[model samples]
Target: MIIIHSLRFLIGLALLLVLTLPLQAQEARVTTARVEERVIVETIALNGSVTAPRTAQLSSDVEGRITELPMSLGDRVQAGDRLLSIDAEDVALQVRSADADVGEARAALENARRRLREGNRLGEGRNIASSELSQRETDVAIAEAALERRRAARDRLEVRLERHHLRAPFGGRLTHHDVAIGEWATPGTPLLTLIDLEHLTLEFAVPLDLHHRLDQAELEVRLPAGIDDWLPARPIADVPLEDGASRQFLLRAMLDDPPTMLPGMAVQGRLLLRNGSGPAVPRDALIRRPDGSISVWLAREEDGEWRATERRVTPGASHAGRVAIQQGIEADDRVVLRGNERLEEGQRLILDDE
Candidate 1:
């Protein structure tokens, strides 16, 4: 009976010792950082194409056989440089004929004026009859009208002669030419294509919602096909019309110091939108759930222990490696940066030393 009592006493002592032992701590080792309010500049990426500011397909104004083509394809020309010359031989001959006619008319006019003066002098002394003087005056008037007609004809021929040579209207590179020496060039026929390469314009399209942000932002352009660096750009204008199908608007800008960028080259543009100050956290702290929601594991002090609490957050633009938290998180909040994927709600946390 004494042995049985001693066994019961030993069992009771063991139970008391187990009940008095402290529970194992449920703690997770994690890296943490304090959320900070920073001035975040968001960027919108857009694809576009590079284009020449001025492009033209030059055509002949007069019909003639091509006599001389001084500027060939891919030739650089300054403004007023002669690109093509049609056969001006016939036109030149016509101008000369007109000039001779003008000279003849002037000589005849002078002879008529001399006769009129002589007749007037004779009439003053009654040596010439009134009818004779009237006839001389009419001859002078006819000669004056003939002279005017000849002068007008000569001017017209000279103007036609000027059209035989096709001159460059602006300084540009000749990109195309179809007319060759001895080829017949008809009026309105395309002769060459000119493009001004000094000034280049980048054409892009963006959504309407970002119009306000783009207006106040700085823009940079990357020509994916030609240039390797991002070039600074200045906004020129936006087309007042919107694309009905895409629901987007067209924008144009001039690239500063562009390098060998040609028309129709594909480009990517970055618009930096300054969105003031906001609470930002490391991108590693963000957790994307299966429900298509984004949340973060925040370290909160609960019952004298730091615990991980999952909070749904509204994320804004991201810059560098950090994300802007627009809502559900505040500045100075401790967020789990590492080991967040294994974190559970209300799980005890042991923050790593910085």
Candidate 2:
């Protein structure tokens, strides 16, 4: 009876070991990376839009019927290029009449001067009276004043004639044009909209708290729909005043040789803050738990087998898929980069490379 009972106990122990060995020796396939000491520049994500330095709604300064529309919608124009021409026949006729009056005035002034010279010679010979010479001098003064008045009138008429043609104020592209030949254009009426695409900028509404950090931060921007590569940018100026509705402030930056971009296009920005350096690992190594605590799985070698160890870490700045470890991990420590999602403490790891 004793032998049978002992044999039964040994068999039960063997069965229990068989059941647990498979579970204990199970290995999790994973990939690993070593922590590196790098210059980690922290950054804040920003939402912004592309904008041009100059956008204008051009209009005619004078009222007239449009006789010539040199530029149409989507046309590029240079500074001083004629955009529209008005009917200037009436104004040109008035200028011509003024020019004739100026010529007549000059002739009258020359005649008056000749009479005054003769009068002075006659008075020196005592042949003309003093009162007569005084009258001659007064006539010359009146004639000279008449010439100046006529010239002033001609200059005014010439300016009016020039205003009949509207020229571009700056180099840009016409975005809006609705006027046609024989259409009546009046002052203060928008004829076309012009936008300068060469000098493009970016405008962002940033939180007020980050205003102080802008002085030392470098900016990088990318157009979400157009360019995927990040481009460097420099801060132009800030409004300094806050927007009451959004609780944010306006910040503008100039792009460095940006690709083709249009105003109002959405752009993403990263304001890089170069504060310090620390040990970092690929972003995939991070594991966020349900309790709002962040941790990482570190692979440690023990007894010639690689095992996973749960480590709580304080993460700082991140850039380019790598995150700086503020606390808990050391440089050169092996971190499980891939296949760490379901890892358990002290679980054996089967490295993919092996």
Candidate 3:
């Protein structure tokens, strides 16, 4: 009877212990995500600026007084549109004079040819001397030569007249207008500055050591307006020349489909250098410790029960809010994304999805 009473007291103490324990001590709710295997690439952030493919200083090829200064700063123009016109009256008169000379030369040539034709006909009937016919033919040749010279002179004057008008070589906007109407324009002196807006390039000064990796890396650019999307860019030019002072080289890249951005606008870019592939998880799942170690909590299923396990991980390059796990994890592993901070080893896991 004493042994039975002792057994009943022990059973009561066991029941009391179970009721006194907190419900949280048994299981905790957690949010988890499956690990994904993907390619991991290292990225180098860069600060750069936008630049147009063509920026030209428009100027006249001939010396003259500016007669028409039609374009102002910020005027968009098409190719071959005249921006400035020089006083072309003198050239126009010269062209007219050359035209008259060509006409006289042509009339003289026609008369000479008629005489040569008459001499040839008389020579064929043995009525003209061979020396005389030859002389007539020589006259025709000399007149033809004179006509060609006059026509060449006329064409040259017309070209000079065209040069009096300064036209845009490409479609662009005028960034600067330095010359004014009635200003004495000289050859090679810039009158305006034009920047091509159709094609743009992103310019970056990258470290010399990483220059070689630019070809293997993918490039992207973003504007300074706090936009989230990155524009895809490709390397257009890598100047092999390096700056001695900065130890950097120029890298010019172009976007596949670029937004409207002004030249010289500040931009940001990144060079993504792919190294290898590995399992990755959301960044939230990572727990950084003060001791410079990184860890993650994982949910494991065994015997129809879920439990939590803390595992130390070696993190690699992170991209798109996910970090590649170089070690201590596998693809399809259930990583605790939320409530991982308060987790303890061997604790029961009640998944939020459940």
Residue-level lDDT tens digits of model 1 in 252-320: 999667677778888899887888999999899999999999999999988888889999999999976
lDDT of 2 by residue, 247-279 (tens): 778889997777888888998988888877789
Which pairs, if any, clash in model 2? none
Ranking by TM-score: 3, 2, 1
Instruction: Give the per-residue lDDT of model 3 (tens digit) for 1-354.
Output: 999999999999999888868665768899999999899988888999998879999889999899997888899999999999999999999999999999999999999999999998999899999999999999999999999999999999999999999999999999999888888999988889999998988999888899777668988888876677988888888876544888888889988777778998999998888988889999999999899999999999988888999999999988888888999999999999998878889898999976
Question: After superposing candidate 1, which stretches have Cα over 4 Å from the reference?
Answer: 1-32, 40-42, 95-156, 212-214, 226-229, 242-245, 274-276, 298-310, 336-353
Candidate with the greatest TM-score versus the true structure: 3
RMSD of 3: 5.5
| Candidate 2 structure lDDT | 0.90
Worst 10 residues of 3 by lDDT: 236-245
Q: After superposition, how far is residue 89 of candidate 1 from its true place, in Å?
A: 0.3
Q: Can you rank all candidates by lDDT, best first?
A: 3, 2, 1
Evaluated at residue 183, the lDDT of candidate 1 is 94
Q: Kindly give the number of clashing pairs for every candidate.
A: 0, 0, 0
